[model samples]
Target: MNAGPSTAAGSAELRGEPPLVVDLDGTLCYSDTLWEALLLFLKHHFWQAWRLPLWLLLGKAGFKAALAGRIALDPGALPYDQTLQRELEHQRAQGRRLVLATGADQRWAERLAAHLGPFEQVLASAGGVNLTSRAKADALVRLYGAHGYDYIGNSRADLAVWQSSRHAYSVTRKPFRLADGRHTEHIGSVRPQPLAALWRAMRPRQWLKNLLVFVPMLAGHALNAGALAQSLLAFAAFSLCASSAYLLNDALDAHDDRRHPDKRRRPLAAGTLPLPLALAASPLLALGAFTLCALFDPLLLAVVGIYLAATLAYSLRLKRMLMIDIVTLALLYTVRILGGCAATLIAPSFWLLAFSFFVFLSLALLKRYSELFNLHSRGQDKSSGRGYTVADKAPISIMGINSAFLSVLIFMLYFNSQTVLTMYRHPYFLLGIVPLLVFWLGRLWTLAFSGQVNEDPVLYVSRDKVSLTVLALCFGLALAAT
Candidate 1:
């Protein structure tokens, strides 16, 4: 413990000043412990989630204590409001008593206090009592007498406490009106617009992957306006569903993401985006996706249901498994093509499925390899939330390289099939795409090996000049064949 300012206690004795009490969630800490603990509980003990309502029946305090007892959160890893912390330290240096008063469970309060404080006292929820709002105000009034202490807090729940305190300080973006007609000091400026943060969290760039939904329509030569419109609708639906999955994945991974070099900047992980909003938006987005699917063919909706289920499974458990995670990722990409076929009422060709599977499989492996490579570069042996160690890098690269070549071979066989003759006016023009595919895949792996590829390979390809150029060339070749 940092016993700040050796003469602080003696100094406070000379001056009779009110103790400074600070809120925990959203005031001193950028995150809510309850939400973080709950998400982690669900992530690790999903089966026991049925007990949540039962626990809640024990009242808010019991529910919080139950969760704290089950999972141990690292207080040091939490995102704290640095500005507020600095102000608290300054006050402590001035010999003002600092109190940590929060609605969080006593366990978390004590842990956080020990990790980052010279707090004179810790007040929090305990013994089946939830210390918040009116209860918190009443307790403080009883302990320090009404208007005898200064308080710093955030959120509407703090209003009652502010009314009971002598001075009010806030960390919230919006100004609050104190019922007691006292001034509330704003500590920091408002964060970036919620819409901007939401947009980033939605990750519209990844929607590029949803473009695969148009592949079946293009391959089947269903260029009619009606077919094109349906494919576009399928694209929109899949994009929304994919965003929903991304939100859920980010929420579950927020803790682990903080340990990552790049992912730590994600909205939820960085605390720029509120966890409750992310959790709420996730299901709403899924509902909107399903609503869009309902406007299309029934089969398309069924395909989307499968896609959502698979994505949920992948986010929940499959992603933590070794090889299974990679295969599941490839299957998700193939599902987009299936959605296209269902939307346009086109039968999927065996060759199309075979080529897509191997191609996406290779890309999936590349994604994992990139993550492992980053970890290895940092001298870490194991990935934070993954099953792979640095030692698996070589085998993953070999398998990925082979999968890429196998996909090329599948495309070659596809060019020779009678199906190719029916769709192309000049079938031999399609052969030009083979070398382009090989070069693109080889270049991607080379970058991964050299540590240039630091994110998902599919997302990387969207921004990669060389890969985009290769894609354009392949498209031109296909257009000539058509």
Candidate 2:
């Protein structure tokens, strides 16, 4: 259905009106099909990602052609600009010939044209030459001659075509009227303010997880200016790394996230944040993290690198692997504590590391349990975008509770260890931590079982008043023992 500009003019003449040509990416739709295909490529055929730059060397049109050939996007699922659609339908009803003219590969443009149905003709890139800017203008002029067609487009690249058109309909964030007597109608509503959406995407509140990097200083009783500075640097490095991981996760999950009620509103899934920006920011943030860690200690940098690798694995594949996903999540938390140890040059104690692993394992299971609960409540049989089934809920609850109890046992054993006796003035004061932990764990599990927990367990604890009070009491007791 990709008809040339001449076909558009012929069709326009038969309809007795100028054809309406609409830009696809960023104009008729809020998203770019190229970026969409790229993400889909990474998600399903990730191994083929290294081939991307090679394809781009041929040119943007060739790159897009190669990518579009590999992935078939469901046009009905795309986030189209509803206002534009309504306006196009009105014009279509008035006997205007509608044409979909875009720089996107002809395959996707054709698919979308058929899916959306307003476009009688699709004018798009066939191969080497991208149909944009001057090329687009020439094609329009060849078909309809000077000022014989109307162009609706977004971005500066569209200005060339707009200038050649009888009427210029712009989709822009800023407002202005055409002064050269070319008629224009501004389309699209005021875009949603992005600052709040960006903040949510960064998930600043989740930075609390990086506080684990301070645990080594606290455990080593080295709370001096030097140790505090080291710990702060570690916190910054880990926070940056964590944010980078979150950005990558959101980008990769954008496809599935759109299907979730709450997650659909995420910056990437909702198209509030552009995909190219997210892709660029991820690596820059990771580099900043590595730089901070390198300045602190090479060993710290190494640990941060491993943490990033593990997280990337989790985001890419491990998250789909059933019970292994929870175990990997636990390991990720324990690695943060290890990062703290490296930052402060403290030797990790087996008792503390073991305790961290088991506790975090329980919390990880709680996260999955919460997700399952959400699905079960909605009468769904299985967790969406996950491997877990609703039938496994009881077993997960049992395993989570067992892991929690095991962490408490490890803490009790640590109190009886020679290390505790050597490091503490009053070792028995540490015993109080066990009961406090028991109560907190029990409360958390009880809440999760009743389907009251929707957030990650770590995040839940950070915001809960009771959890905060228990944490303070546990810290006070540990300080008393020290």
Candidate 3:
């Protein structure tokens, strides 16, 4: 909703007019407190989620009250409709009384009213009564008579109340037309780019990590047509499952993401992608992933299932644990290589697993180091959701650098192994990759120290020219050795 002040002037014409009534969810605020509270509850109490159905059996009002009592959503951090808020403030400045009527819990309604305005009264669901639709219309009519006050709303449920109001002002995607010939005007419209927002929410750029699923086939020199085809299928399945996990993670973190400087612009956190739509899309993506995996092989499906499970565990609980988060991230990366081995029917190499684990661990720690470095630069001591502080940044960098060198040593040892002698005609060419790895890792750490890397290192590598050059040279060296 992005209407300008000129649109608000229309309401000024009604001098000494009746009090203005405003809807809460989707009208005054860009998000629904009820849905946000429910998500927060599920996020924190996932182990006790059975309580949700039992609470809902208490009815909508009772369910909302129960959630409100359990979780306290921060009112100040909510994404309010700024344009509509300006209009409300203008009306208030004009001395017109304002009433906040919402289907959200009474506590949330009063909290928002106190936080954002001069509402004379707050009417919301309470004491087992869900004050919405017809009930809200009746209550307003009882207090101010039919057609005595103007109304502003943004959903079909508010149509009943609009029918009983003096005038209708809408902020929905489409304007409302009353059949009773009452005046109606569109104040604003929530015209989001649904397809673009959905695509962004999927985080397709992060799918680059799924390319690791091809490593096993490439490493074992299994580039036959069938092996290539199976590996491609495995990559697709992993990408889809990864996307599903990303969506769920974003939905769960939307509240806290809104407080982070960079993450706040994400689709779910910024309200560009609706929470309900994101939640619905996540399971469908996972189902599609499993279907693809099944078409390849049951073994491949089992591997993808484990990856999904680990990802869900990380998103749900492991991400907040101290060093466990980084370890989990590294293992998730290694799982992609394992998936490739399953797809290509290749025996996994101990050397490949060891090298990948340490390299990815280094990358994961680099990511956390960047985050904490940024926080420290901002004069903040602690990360929002993770278990890290500014003081941990130095040690994190040291650990990450050591891990990178350890991966290099593993790669050197793998070159000396019989496996490398049988696979590569000129095994010495592979040693050139070591210096490139060292240079890239050193430069990455330097960039992190200088605050040049501010996001996922994998993502940053995709865009960094130096990193890309290093990767291209590494691939060239491997091809030469083969």
Candidate 4:
């Protein structure tokens, strides 16, 4: 976002004119400090969220102060608007006074001012009174008199303060109506369209993982139209649940994710998606998923509940454990098959369970291995939010390859079983599947080791022409055996 031409009175302020007061949240910074405080509170002091209403009953200022005291907000890591920062610097160079006025707690406001280094004064929430709207307007009016200072802000709450200012500049493209005939210019187009950012934050691409919900129906050859419809419903529920988990993870991991080159562009980390919106959407999505699951089948709903619990646990803690992390990921994948079984009333098969564990474990290990490889290439020794290190690269590779081979062994054992003979008229034809599995697994690991498999292994296979062809051949072989 860039600044537009300032009004004559606003531009005159560049030559030692009246003070310029800038709102902090959504004006000076792309993200809101209040939302940052809320996220930090939920991430570290989650138990305190229940007490927020009680504190707010006392007042907004007191609530903000209480929350801000507990959160360790890093001012330097905040998503400040680059254009606003540059404009502030330019105004500073001209010896113009800059004041930061915000409804955010004074503690956070001070830290931000200290970090940014241009603000001469910070007027913010304090003493149980929230400094916003009318309060802010009154304070500025008392300090600088009506129309004595130029104000810059974004939200509608800023309208009250802008009414008292000499001129207004904003971070929004929407024209601010000035009843008092004061000039208003849009300084930059900073915030993303809320609906679009929310959609992106849901991460539609990752929903591909939920297709695992159809595994059991396909494997059992019971995929008639009715079963297909049920599986589709199950798929939708899992997708919603998965998106909820992802939003929770992204919000909690925002600080760490910002340090990563690729992850920094994620909506939450980039400050394009509002943190409050993410927080609101997560539980709503989870509820919607559970509701849909309940309407389908109680057993399926229970399985989905377990999946959500396990996923949340993984995001909160298990993901940091060494082998346990990968094991949990494997279980999460296997649960999808369980969900499918419940949806279709298919009895659980040991072969399918074992195969899923081994395969997904290998893929999970590949994910970590790729992360370590990237860190190694960057001269970093540790993987963020993970127990793995650059030195553990060889072990991860060995384990991933071995796990993949173990899955192949499971497939071979399944083919040799009496169950295979009972199910297939010509079970011998299934031997063709073994070589395909071997080739796919071998090629997958080779690419991962060579840093070619940089995305989720499932997503990789979905996009890879070679993997797709091998998969088709394997399916054909299985059909011939049956």
**Which candidate ranks first by lDDT, i.e. highest?**
1
lDDT: worst 10-residue window of model 4: 1-10
Poorest 10 consecutive residues by lDDT, candidate 2? 1-10
lDDT of 2 by residue, 427-469 (tens): 8899999999999999999999898877488888888999999
* Candidate 1 C-alpha lDDT tens digits along 1-482: 12322234544441367888889998888789999999999999999999899999999999999999998888866777776677677777777789999999999999999999779899999998899999999999999999989888888999999999977778766668888667677774355665677789999999999999999888887879999899998999999999999999999999999999899889888888888999999999999989888875778899999999999999999999999999999999999999999999999999999999999999999999999889988889999778999999999999999999999999999999998988899999999999999999999999899999866988888888999999999988988888
TM-score of 2: 0.89
Off by over 4 Å in 3: 1-15, 181-184
In candidate 1, stretches whose alpha carbon ends up further than 4 angstroms from where it belongs are 1-16
If candidate 4 were superposed on the true structure by all CA atoms, what would the RMSD be? 2.3
Error of 3 at 4 (Å): 6.5
Q: Where does candidate 1 have its weakest 10-residue lDDT segment?
A: 1-10
Query: What does the lDDT read for residue 12 in candidate 2?
Result: 42
Q: Which of candidates 3 and 4 is the stronger one according to TM-score?
A: 3
Candidate 4 matches the true fold with a TM-score of 0.93
